[model samples]
Target: MKTAVEKAADTDYRELSVSPHLITEAKSALMHFERLCGRYQQMYNTQVQANKLFVVKAKNARMYISHFVQVLYMSIQRTEIKEEHLSLYGLEECNMIVPDISTNEQLLEWGRKIIEGENIRISRGAVPIYNPSIAKVKVMYTLFKEGYQTQKLHQKATTRVQDEVAAYREKVDKLILDIWEEVEKDNMDLATDQRLDRNRQYGVIYYYRKGERV
Candidate 1:
């Protein structure tokens, strides 16, 4: 609808006896709409895709953490470390008692503490667990963090674009309506079909009922 209005204002306004100012207004509105739509689409896509990646990364991190805990139990059993040593691996109990790291925020805090505790323990002459070790868990957590931050950024961008689009929507609608009315009034002397054809050349929109002939 706005596209037709823009072209009408540019090339058909003089013929349709419409004001030239409508052309500039339509162009500005159309340009802003185009930019807003493009930006909004980009932000929405980034948010969606980033969130999906974050979910996968988060799941991967959770799986690795579970594996690390299993290995920690076995590894500690073979060592001289006591139950008190469980705290060094970010666990309070030695019997598979893990925190409820479900939400992304919880997972973030859990993973960070686990990595830090493991690092501290390893530095204190503790052997690093093999296979699904803290290093691997850290990698997964880092990926999850990256995806989470990206999704957050684009979510805000999408919201800002939505607000701008909302604020400008009525203005664009009014401009298009004004241009349509002026063009139709100028071409009113012609037959309905002829006037419709003329109006279309000036960017007029027509809506036909469903199942009705065009």
Candidate 2:
């Protein structure tokens, strides 16, 4: 009733003899490749030359992954179980396959979320949005968590600094007023002493120095 290819398509790769580690590595590589593609779209010509080697590596890794998947799929097809047969599928074709969030729909959603997300600043020249990593959601989650905490700490520090500056300015103003009062009092005393000396010279009065009369 069903062709071999169709039956193969329905097989569950999880039930097969595939190595979970290799599958995890393949998924990570695919996500990394997609992220690179997003970055490549925004790169300048200068970066193209500098990133040539990375590009080559991504391409080779992609090819290796494709080849490995095919081999693994074929090897797994050799043995069949009574319940569910295991088969390999592309990154997006099956439930367990990682989704390429680099797609237009996913990217648009990410951009909207970033616009609404707290403490996220988009520079005029900065990349519009972060590209989503597929299988490496754990990595993205860690980075975003760290970034959010760091931003909150920075805001708290800035607020404290502002309060300290305001208090310092008030203290400085009070000190200045006190110094001015002292200076004015000293000047008035000196002027009164000069006037008394003139008056005494004209025989108008007697005067006393701070402790002893003269």
Q: What is the TM-score of each candidate against the true structure?
A: 0.71, 0.27
lDDT of each: 0.78, 0.37
Cα lDDT of model 1 by residue, 1-214, tens digit = 5656555546644464466777767778888888988888888887887787778888998888777776777766777455677887568753666677788887888788888988988898887777987888899889888877877788888999999888888888898788889888888899979988888877785889999884
- Residue pairs with backbone atoms closer than 3 Å in model 2 (clashes): 12-86, 13-87
What tens-digit string does per-residue lDDT give for candidate 2 at 1-214? 0121122234465532223343344344435444554444434333445345444433433333334334333433554211122221222233333233333344333323323321122232322222232223333333444444444455565555555555555544443344334334333444667745533332234446888854
Following a full C-alpha superposition, what root-mean-square deviation does model 2 have from the true structure?
35.4
Query: Candidate 2: worst 10 consecutive residues by lDDT?
Result: 80-89
Candidate 2 error regions (>4 Å): 1-133, 188-214
